[model samples]
Target: MPIRQLPDTLINQIAAGEVVERPASVVKELVENALDAGATRVDIDLEEGGARLIRIRDDGAGIAAEELPLAVSRHATSKIASLDDLEGVATLGFRGEALPSIASVSRFALISRRNGAEHGAALEIDGGRLGEVAPKPHPQGTTVEVRDLFFNVPARRKFLKAERTELSHIEEWLRQLALARPDVELRVSHNGKASRRWKGEGDLLSDVRINETLGEEFARNALRVDHSGAGLRLHGWIAQPAYNRASADQQYLYVNGRAVRDRSIAHAVKQAYADVLFHGRQPAYVLFLELDPRRVDVNVHPAKHEVRFRDSRLIHDFVYRTLHDALAETRAGSAVGVADAQPAYDPAQAARPDYNWRVPTRPLGLQVEETRAGYAALYGAPRAELAYGAPAPAGEAYAPPAGLDGPAPHPALPHSDDASLPPLGYAIAQLHGIYVLAETADGLIVIDMHAAHERIGYEKLKHAHDGEGLRTQPLLVPAALAVSEREADVAEREAPTLAALGFDVTRSGPQSLTLRSVPALLAHGDVEALLRDVLADLREHGESRRVAAARDELLATMACHGAVRANRRLTLPEMNALLREMEATERSGQCNHGRPTWARFSLSEIDRWFLRGR
Candidate 1:
């Protein structure tokens, strides 16, 4: 087959496929053009998510009558004059494919006056065919209207989402653009009704804009971060460590005034928050990075959503370290206390719970002991002095506090754990031809032989009673616990609970706590350092678990210790034994926690993945 030339209309349509993926794409391109034209005020109106109608009016350098016809032509622009300009392209748009691509799939009209013109000229293009250019409107700026989008391309039209979903996308586009250029007042309307508007300079005013677009609650609970690093400056606001959203849709990022989605930046931000937030929970942030535009590439996508960076590692570390340090500073202040970071306590409705323990009077550190005997001697009922880096045995019959119920020694009850388990039960099920299950009955039962056990061990040490609810090993001398003013407040409120959990604490000063005795569970653990760490976690995560739930959760962690792991292959009897354990355990129906330990698809569902089901 010989290569042949594609028709102009078809060429424009193909370009449209890349540049005009949705109504929001159209808005974005037009808005970028408006801003590029040095528009001070832009008004955008849409109907049917820019399907039926879209009108963008901007007070900018209007198009000349002679240039009006070429405006709808492809590869025509005044943004770049030479190839050298491409290396330092600072404007939002430069490709000049926006107008032609938009006109190809939609009924496009442009009316503009070149400031000194007697009257504005109008040009119309329907399905990529140019109509006659004539004098029409009386305006000193430009106003573009696109209607009946995708009328000539019915297939694209069919792929459009619901009006609301499309409108949401359009709104998001407008928001990012507005944020990028806060000096340019922007007003967006869908179906002739106002949806969002922004009026301000593009500083760290994202909080105000977010409030206007999302809600006031976001504005009130935002954490403002403004810092500069080597060759890069970052300024934005993140929700308090504890405040989070269900989706990452609320996370907005901009590099050098251009909205972008750089995975490295996102990963770095997440790493900075490692262990601070719960799994699957996303934090809300409006982050902006200011750097030399020459160091970044914005030409990766036709939509300009993703960008390539020259030094991604450097940028990532800068963003992560800046936000992380900023958060620490804010947490230390009384204006944003530990209580304010908690989600469970609403300061607007009710008084927040005491979390004074989050304030630290000492530096933080970590140490691990392997043997049960080592742990026992270090933090036993009668605490003993022990040397560091000592090897110890693994197994011991450790007991819970005097009043609490310990694990049962008798055999588990006879029952099918899967059949009796509640919704989301079935902790772990055998995956092979034979079905094996693990569950908990008494307190919490783990199903997996591996994952459950590891998770249980991790959580046990995570929430153990060493200081708070676990037993404590006393230091030869009392350690000083650093306490922030807010942490002091939290400690004062939850002192009784802390005491019940085996912590003997006293307020040493305005910003200090004195430790007398820690819980037996944490006997060897550094009481001074752990309390501060716990205080920080509590501030960010809210109150530690209540007594009842705490006990169950701890038991669940313990159960996870004995569950099967994924890689640990078992014999038929071992699998059968695991099944019996799950059946005997009460919570065995599910994992130690609420996550589904197993999911069973019927024969029909299995057939679907293989394309066998019709």
Candidate 2:
């Protein structure tokens, strides 16, 4: 066959194969167009899961009567023009193929009246054939109606699911949109009945949206994260480790106000929650990242659901460090339940914790100091220092005291000034020899003794072990490794980064490497395998955490071994010391395994539970 050009309608139908996959895909493209038009309110009316009809109305700056014909033309868009505009497109709908592509496979009509227009105009397209523009009375906005989706393409229509299933997909996509934009009012109607609505909350993002989208529990456990640095800014809410989900369904990332999925960013978040989250549990977050539009390429995906970062390493490091530090500030008692709302905290006036881990009145068996000493001997490293201002090893600084029985109380405090009581409050008694019962100002507190102690020990172990940075163990003979030429190039280029991570990597040939040393903590395990994994990570994310993750896992096991065991009897003073230490420890709300270590039961809730307030 001779080379020939396809008809205009054929070209659009082919593009529709990529842009219009289902009813949900059509909704995504049209709604994005609405948002780009500066629409504050968008009403969507769907019939039969949008297979039979989909009418989208938006109060935005509409197109002019003269431009109505070009609006549905292929390769026409108001979003971008020159190459520069394509490179740094800030709007959500930049590709001009959406309208034309969608119009080709369905019955489409577009009516609009620019905000200041004297009249309105409408145009209809049936099966890619255009109709003359006709005068139509419409408000100062745009209305797009699509009917019989995939009517011209029977093969594609057959692949669509049932009505309920298609509507569910639309709802899910709308949820993603709603999270990224709390200031936009969105309403949905199915079969002429209202299905859902998200009220506009302005640009100032608050927990009300989060509470409505996720749940009251998530908002209650959420930690506000607002940070900016190095030409980038990340601000949103991340649920505490205790409120993790079973899958990645709750993770939402928006780059420059456009929802997207980037594996590098996801990995960074997972790494940040590594130590605190339970095994196999996914953390919940609604994060929005903002950076110069030029630094990211959004043209990679047809749906624009992913982006390529110019400086992936820089972005990954920034995200990891930001979330890591924020989690570090998740001290015990910092989070508040919805019912226990209180005045903003003033850290300046906060009382410094005086954890009385000092010499007890008498000898007590099974002190934490003994556990640390035992582990220090087992690992042949220096005895560790305790956290929360606990005294150091004997004769080094302040030797931590462990009294299985004796009590060492604070000197004095004015009872009237309740601010002096630490956030975890003082332990009053033990329950079932496993739980610690404490009293707070507003209500009662229940704590898992072992879980709480395990977290405290883990933090101390990390500080003591990492105080001097990662230690490297030189191999007796440098090990040779084989790899792709590109991988080998990455290895050679990132030699300094490898060195900082306690690795000595040198390029030997076009596709080979020489490893002279490895992290001391992981030197025994196949160093070559570790090298391969690290190189692969560096190639993609521009950074690697395989070594650190291994090291932390080992530390976590040791911490678990050294933590106080359940069913162990505790003296009043011993329990109080543990509570105070919890108050000062980082990420103390959860154990090393990600389970919450403590829970607060407010007076109001307690009253309701017992029917005292009913």
Candidate 3:
């Protein structure tokens, strides 16, 4: 077979596959084009999930009649003058493929007039064939319409999800853009109804505007973050520690003025909040990072949503440190109450509706069925109860031990059920407020009063971890460390395991751990010192074969060193729970570090203390 050049239309369609993945991609391209044209106000309307129609009107410098023909031509752009300009490409739509690529698979129209033109001209293209530019009337700026997206490619069109999903993507895309340019007025309509509208005044502090677009509750809980270092400026708001979501969709990041989803920024934020939050929960934030444009490369991707920094390591460190400092300064006791409990929306300002499109709704129990089915579905088995055919067991559950050292069984000690002696090994004495003092047969036991209860819960988690693996939290910022000589050696050996625990530990120098990731549980822990400590410990102990075993040792070290201190006060149930967990635990004999966790006292000590005659 002889090789031949692919057709122009096919090439354009191929490019469209990269730039226009969905309705939102189309909106992103057009709106960006409008912004590049100096649009201060933009309007977007979608119909039939942007498959039937998408209209974007912008108030900016518009194309003249002569330029109308070239607007839909590939590589025809004013954003770049020569190939050298590619080195520091800044515009969001410089590829100049968006217009032509979009026109390749859909019916496209461009109507525009310069600021002082008598009348605007409109150019139409259907499936890449350009129609004659005809005289048309329009105000300053431009209006671009896309209809029947992927009409010529049935395969692409067929893959489109329900209308609502498509619309949601469009909404999300617009929201990120609006956040990037808070000064720009943006209005969005779906079908024929206005769903969102924002004021155009160049106000920078209109958190309310952002709230209107991104739920009001988010705005209310967001923490204002502002910092500058080494000629760089970072500004944005993050949700309070307690306010987080299950998905990372809530994280919005911007570089300069373009919305981006860079991992460095996400890693930094996670490191900042590592210890205080739990796994699978994401922090909500809208962060803006500003650096010299020359120091960053925005041309890495055609979509312009990811950038390459000149010194990524430095930038990562800066972001991590800044957020960490800000979080530290924030009062731990500060009320987490929402600034505005209820969102303020004008009922009269109704959102436009697309009556022609179906309102997307998933079937009830669809998720439940999928989750419950699991492997059953994979094996082509019908859904059924996991315990099908087994009658429910009938009985009163076993009663908890009535007292510490109760029934000659120590409830909190690991070896209590050794078939030799009770775990707690003592009888409960008089209960005083929150403390539980007990007498054992051998040693006099004095329990933590509180940890007595927490031990049980911690044991369950630890056992689960031993069977599976330790639970990890991604840090909000990477910790920094100038590792000690010994520490450096051990850190190098266990670096990978530490990373799995959610610490972004990178060896900057032979003796340095330029920490980028920290354990999620130590979100706010001092990164530098922690690295030093971990490494030092590893250096003290020889290398172990099993990484999992090493991780357990590290975890034990962390738990012993990080859990609530012994002297701290506790409630009755908390103390009791700790005791119960200790009883159920295999390591209840000692704390994570092999330190005796508790002391036992015998009932005979009471008579001796009371001075009663024997």
User: Model 3: residues >4 Å from true position, as ranges?
Assistant: 335-614
* Predicted candidate 1, C-alpha RMSD: 20.4
Each candidate's number of clashing pairs is: 46, 2, 50
Model 2 Cα RMSD, 1 decimal: 5.9
Give one digit per residue, the lDDT tens place, for model 2 in 385-470. 33222445576543336543333442322232244456666567899999998876667789998888888888988898889788
Please give, for residues 1-614, the per-residue lDDT of candidate 1 as tens digits.
Answer: 89999998999999999999988899889988988888988999999878899999999999998898788888999988887777667888888899999999999999998888889999999888899989987568899999999999999999999988988888877777765676788988887789767885554553446666546666655766778868899987776545566789788898878888887788767755543344687877888898887788877888778888887757776887787665433211113311233222122111111112222331111111212222343234222113123333455323334554422122333233222222212223444522334333222222344532333343445445433545445556777767689887666666775776666777878888777777654465455555665555345433342332344444555655544445655543233233322222222222333333333333455467789945
| Tens-digit lDDT string for candidate 3 (277-315) | 445677788888888877888888877778888877567
- Note the residue pairs that clash in candidate 2: 391-398, 392-398
Task: List TM-score per model, in order.
Answer: 0.56, 0.88, 0.60
Model 3: ten consecutive residues of lowest lDDT: 347-356
- Report lDDT (Cα) of residue 239, candidate 3: 75
Residue 151 of model 2, lDDT score? 95
Q: Stretches of candidate 2 above 4 Å error?
A: 336-420
